[model samples]
Target: MRSQFLIGSRAPSIEMLTWICGKPVFALQRGTIYIVALFSTICPHCPKTIADLGQLHEKYGDTGVVAFGVAAMERAATADEAGARVDTWLNKELPNPTISIAFEHTGEMNKLWWVASGSYGVPTIFIVDRDNSIAYIGYPDTEDPALLERVLTKVMDGSWDNSAEAKKAHEKWLQGALVRRANVALSIKDFKTALSTIEELNEAIPDNPQFREAHIKVLLEMMHDFEAGWIVLAGLARDAIEKNDGDWLLAAMQQLFGSPYDYSCLPSAERFSMGKVLSERILTLCPQQDGISRAISYGAVARYFYESGEINRAVDSIEHALELVEGESLPDGEKQNYLAPLVQALAEYKGSEIPREFAEDPQNRS
Candidate 1:
């Protein structure tokens, strides 16, 4: 099913049934305008947005503005599962009446609200009029009191034109829907769907640099198709080098070692060569005298050796990096941060011999 939602069109009536203080409430009533915030309970940014919606609900509930939060738990299947997620979130930290409208979707409400309500990112806010037409779509961060007031005023008076600007806004919102679907697919390791979504988006928005570049990274990580990913990275790197863009170099390095996926599969020799080049370039740019940069460079080197099956070298490199962190005159939390994982990995491996410095005692501080 196509998940794209367009604004300035008929808003689908989604049944929102969730609980508050053990009492269930229905979200839709025939004559009331509703502002809904679609969110995920686990999303790091969702709570703050939910808090803002609570404030809006508190101020507007009696007069006509009704706000609700809709969330679909990651593994939710039945109404019971959805309700359990809501209950858990409420029990822990997020408890708001606005969260009372979440329920499991059977695809009916998913199609209706996912796009029109700007569900691309959690904390997406939608202002729907009494007629169920979306009147405003935006992020809470971008929303102003005046904007909310104007929408509410128009919806209450029944005089909104649903302006030309709303149509344009809806189109822009729909474009975000495609990207959002691609991101969710990538998150779940659904490579083919993610690639297809990005490819279509790339075709539709040829001039957009952000879309093209993001798709390239998504293709590499999600598909595990490094050859194509590397080719684009190399091309982009070369272009950036010609332009002397340090930002692009950092971005290229990030794509190389940023994830848990294997770049070492490129061939030990190639991995070592690429690592050496990038490490030298990064050090020349930032020089790891401090804990953070040192840790980052150290991580790149350690990964390079580990991927190449040079466990001894990896151990030595990590030790040296940890030593640098420990030797710092100032206290930097990353020293312990970087060393703890390296120590754990080195300690756990039965096949590889730990380095001399770490072998004497596994708990030895760097």
Candidate 2:
């Protein structure tokens, strides 16, 4: 049931359209370990992943570890142009990074490494053991801070080879493949295939919140099959309320106002009605938490208030999010990054000019 290119399987040879840094590695040396990160120049999450990979290279280079970054998914005029963009981005974002860096122009790396391995999303990682078998394949980051180091250490000591750790990594990445299949199906407007994949995944991996939110998005937003979407979503809402589960309700709110779920075909009344219940439940579950983490929920709260014909409450929620972001020690640019959505929401809620303070004009800043 596992793909041929998997954990315990021989890693595909390193290939790059262009080498951006360090010694060019075309083949995997039998004695060396590797950390191959597939990232994108435009992917906001990639910078951190690349930085982490660089850190690992610094930590493990003397241990015969080969860490390299292959930049993929860059949209430029040509391979040369994309390579140039990656080169510039590295210089600015990661000057003198400790790892080898390459630019993927031909899309071969993507097909062979990412799509072939069944890994989902940007910042995919493949850690090759000394035997050249893929010891780990999945996201570079998780709740576990020392996950990479722990796994790398195991692989180096040969304890992870043919071990249970390898088996779990193999299973998890293969599960990601199901999500990848769903994404591919959705991309081509193959809603039927997408829905089937979602159902199969839900049965197999029910706790994946992103997939759960996405499943509802596909039904209610993409397929416009309100009948099917509500059948599951309404049941989910009732369960969340019955359990007084804030996390469940937060995931449910994505259906109403999440960026990915447009809800164009779903009646506004139905959308607003659901938003009101889910958002209120979230606040009720965690009322005393007014921190920035709680500020994220305010967008959905604002959506509910706006749709329920309480413009003032909606505006207040957006303003609170903006104020919280502003209070952070982040640079003005980063603050704008967080404030952009809230400001846009405020503009919608007010049904009038955006307050002069949050507008993009530099002169408006205090």
Candidate 3:
């Protein structure tokens, strides 16, 4: 199903019920590159994505490039009705869009392009080369977000390598679809599906450690498979420890100590052993005298130490974090986001009431 729409495959035809602006395009024009932005009228925020296309249209229109914004997965009853609604909506959303747009009430365009390519959702973008081949298809703002711009420039300059481009685009394509599917599944509390999909995604994109953590999250927090999740996460923590990967180690520790998930379910021996390793690793990797990076790391490790009954270590860590927050590296105004949370943690660690001096919420302060 997806092979036919892979990079370098002939792009599907532009078939919409109503063409909003520019000459109605039914066939690919020779020697002209095309950029199509797919958006959903049903999505309140999809209008924002059109502006990105509009900017590009104005930027590249003179250079033999054409851009289109097609409304897909609309909620309106008829094609004409959807077209009319979209015209009014675009006028309201973008004020004056330079690119051509079309409306789709039937799901044919989505099925033909989005589903056929295994890409999902609105704001998905496609760049078609002059030869009418599907040069790229996936969400624009992701995994090497500059990929669209890079691919567009390469294709326009007659230097696109399908094998190299597809390697990047295809991975993001699978990731985007699986992420959407995982979200949909999680919304319905279909933990089984969410776990499997995230696991598949994690395996497919090993460079992204967050996906691996997400897989563990779904396993332990959503599916309540504590032992299974711990096994996977512990391996990551061990690797992070060995490699001096502070960021990955921090994420692993947060999964153990941070909330919305019940940490009590974690086995006692495994919990502290992991926390001890992570906390010690973080101490070495994130020196206390640095910027927001250290401040964040210190704050997280503080919680682990505080819970481990090392009150002095926890207090010192939080204090250093608080001091780092006030450093010149962080703007006085921007400090509140970190300050508010750290202040609360400080009061809790000290087993005292939060003083009125620091009682105000950062959000309210702003």
Best by TM-score: 3
**Residue 334: error of model 3 in Å?**
3.1
Candidate 2 per-residue C-alpha lDDT over 237-299 given as tens digits, one digit per residue, 9 for 90 to 100: 665666666667777776556645545655677667777778878877656565655677776
What is the per-residue lDDT of model 1 for residues 1-366, given as tens digits with 9 covering 90 to 100?
343354555666655445444224464565777777677778778777777677777777788767767774335677676667767886676654543456554545555666445465666777777776666676654545455556556667775546564555555665677788888888898888887877777665544445656766775666667777667656554544444444554555555555555666444454456555765565566553466566556655566556557778777766766676666665444445555566655554335665555454334555
Clashing pairs in 1: none
Give the 10-residue window scoring lowest on summed lDDT in candidate 1: 16-25
Candidate 3 per-residue lDDT over residues 1-366, each given as its tens digit: 223344567888775547887656676787899998888756765676677777777788899888888887675677778878887877778777777788777888878887777665567788888988877786756446566777788888877755576677678677777788889899999999888888788777776768878888888778888788878777777767776687787887877786466677767787788889888888787864358889889999999989899999999999999888887466666777788888888999999888775698777774
Best lDDT goes to which candidate? 3
Q: Which stretches of candidate 1 lie over 4 Å from their true place?
A: 1-110, 115-124, 128-189, 198-227, 239-251, 254-277, 287-290, 301-320, 328-336, 340-352, 355-366
> Ten-residue segment with the worst summed lDDT in candidate 2?
257-266
Error of 1 at 154 (Å): 13
Write the number of the candidate with greater TM-score, choosing between 1 and 3. Answer: 3
Worst 10 residues of 3 by lDDT: 1-10
Deviation of model 3 at 41, angstroms: 8.2
Error of 2 at 138 (Å): 6.8
lDDT of 2 at 270: 65
